[model samples]
Target: MLTKLLITDDAAFMRMTLKRIVTSAGYDVVGEAANGQEAVDLYKELNPDIVTMDITMPTMDGIEALQEIKKTDPNAKVIMCSAMGQQAKIVEAIQHGALDFIVKPFDHSRIIEALKKASDR
Candidate 1:
């Protein structure tokens, strides 16, 4: 089955870019969110197979959202996305139950690879 996805990013361009890449790669994008709080809300509503989450956002931030989602659904599949060198946050995300972390500016292969890994879990 094609994986369903929720994309959460504060930047409109990033969301659009990821949507395009994910769609082209054959995953169904079930929802989109502009912040961590929204991501959590949408995750509950959509319950997608995977989520791609940006580290920094207006309301909650990705780490917090990842924790919230994990709390609600221990098996939630989330992949953290950060800019080049947010190493500490990435590690925190993984420790907090994120399945994988991907560095941006968005690589198609990396996104797909992360999705595949998340789906496997």
Candidate 2:
């Protein structure tokens, strides 16, 4: 089955990029959120199989949203996306239940690979 995915990023361009890549790779982009708060809300509404989350965003950061989502549903699969040099945040996200991560400036392969890992999780 196609993996249903929720995309959360503060930037519209990044969200579009991820949506394109994920959809092209055959995963369904079930929803898109411009901020972490929106992400949290959408997660509950959509219950997507996986989520691609940005570490930095207004209203709420991905880490906090991730935590909130976990609180809502522990089995919710989230894959964090971040720019380079945020290893600490990435680790924290993983510790808080992020299934995997994809660094920004992402190529098609990395996005697909991350989605694959999230689906497996």
Candidate 3:
């Protein structure tokens, strides 16, 4: 079966861009969220195979959402997305059980590679 993915970003453009990339790469675009809270809610409902989460957002940030998801499902596969210079937050996400991270504006190859790695684990 195709890998299922939930994409979370505060920017609608980013979510749309990511959806295009993941769908073209053969992943099923299960859902998209404009913020971390929505991401968490969709996660519970969809149970996607992986999540691409942006680190900065209103109504809850990616790290908090990642933590919440991990609390509910320790094995949840999350790949954090962050702008350059957010190294500390990225590190924290990794420590919180994120499978991997991709820098933005995202590179197509890196996004695919991160998804592949997360799905493999």
Candidate 4:
């Protein structure tokens, strides 16, 4: 079976771009969310194999959502998405049970590699 993925990002363009890249890579795009709260809700409903989560968002940012998800499912596979200069938050996310992180503007190879690593764990 193809790996299922839930992509969560506030930016419409980023979501679309990520969807395209992962779909092309042969992952099934199981769900998408615009913010952290939505991500958490979709996570419960879809129970995707992995989540690509954006750190900065309007409501209930990625770290908080990651925490919430972890509380519910300790083994949840989450790969945080971060931009440059968010080192503190990235470290926090990792400490909060995120499996890994992907630096944005989304490197295709890195994204795939992170997914592989997260899933392998």
Candidate 5:
């Protein structure tokens, strides 16, 4: 089965770019969210196979959302997205239950590889 993914990013362009990459790689995008809170909500509603979450967002941050999602589903699969130079947040995300981290400006190969790795875990 094609893995279902929920993409969360405050920037529309980032969401669009991720959607393009994930779809091209044969994953089904179940939903999109503009913030971490929405990501958490949609994660509960959609229960997607995977989630690509941006670290900085309005309402809540990705680490908090990742924690919330993990609380709800301990086996939840999440891969954090951050811009270059957010090492601290990336480490926090991994500790908070993110399976992997993807740096922006999005690279298709990196995204695909991350998804594959996260899905396998």
Candidate 6:
């Protein structure tokens, strides 16, 4: 089965880019959210197999949303995405239960690889 995915990013362009990448890589783009709060809500509603989350967003940050999702479902598969130089935030996300992370601007191979790995887990 194609892995179901929920993509969360405040930027429309970022979300569109990721949606294209993941869908072309053969995963289903189940949902998209423009902010962390929306992400949290969609996650519950969609219960996608995995999530691609952005670190910086209005309403709530990725780390907070990650924590919220993990709180409701410990096995939630979340892969954080951030621009270069957000190592500290990435580490905190991992600590909060992110399955992995993808650094932006995204690499096509890396995004597919991360989704594959997260789906396998």
Q: Candidate 5 — worst ten consecutive residues by lDDT sum? A: 101-110
Q: Residue 3, candidate 3: how far off, in angstroms?
A: 0.5
Model 5 spans > 4 angstroms off: none
| Residue pair clashes in candidate 5 | none
Cα lDDT of candidate 2 equals: 0.92
Off by over 4 Å in 6: none
TM-score of every candidate: 0.97, 0.97, 0.98, 0.98, 0.98, 0.98
Choose 1 or 5, whichever is better by TM-score.
5
- Estimate the lDDT of model 1: 0.93
- Worst-scoring 10-residue span by lDDT in model 3: 112-121
Q: Determine which window of 10 residues in candidate 2 has minimal summed lDDT.
A: 112-121
Residue 75's lDDT within candidate 3 is: 95
lDDT of 6 by residue, 1-121 (tens): 8889999999999999999988888889989999999999999999999999999999999999999999889999999999999999999999899989999998999998898899889
- For candidate 5, what is the lDDT? 0.95
lDDT tens digits, residues 1-121, model 5?
A: 9999999999999999999999999999999999999999999999999999999999999999999999999999999999999999999999988999999998889999999998888
Q: Which stretches of candidate 4 lie over 4 Å from their true place?
A: none
Model 3 has a clash total of 0
Write candidate 2's Cα lDDT for 1-121 as tens digits.
8889999999999999889888888989889999999999999999999999999999999999999999999999999999999999999999999989999898789788877877776
Cα lDDT computed for each candidate against the true fold: 0.93, 0.92, 0.95, 0.95, 0.95, 0.93
Candidate 1 residue lDDT tens string, 1-121: 8899999999999999999999999999999999999999999999999999999999899999999999999999999999988999999898999889888888889888889888888
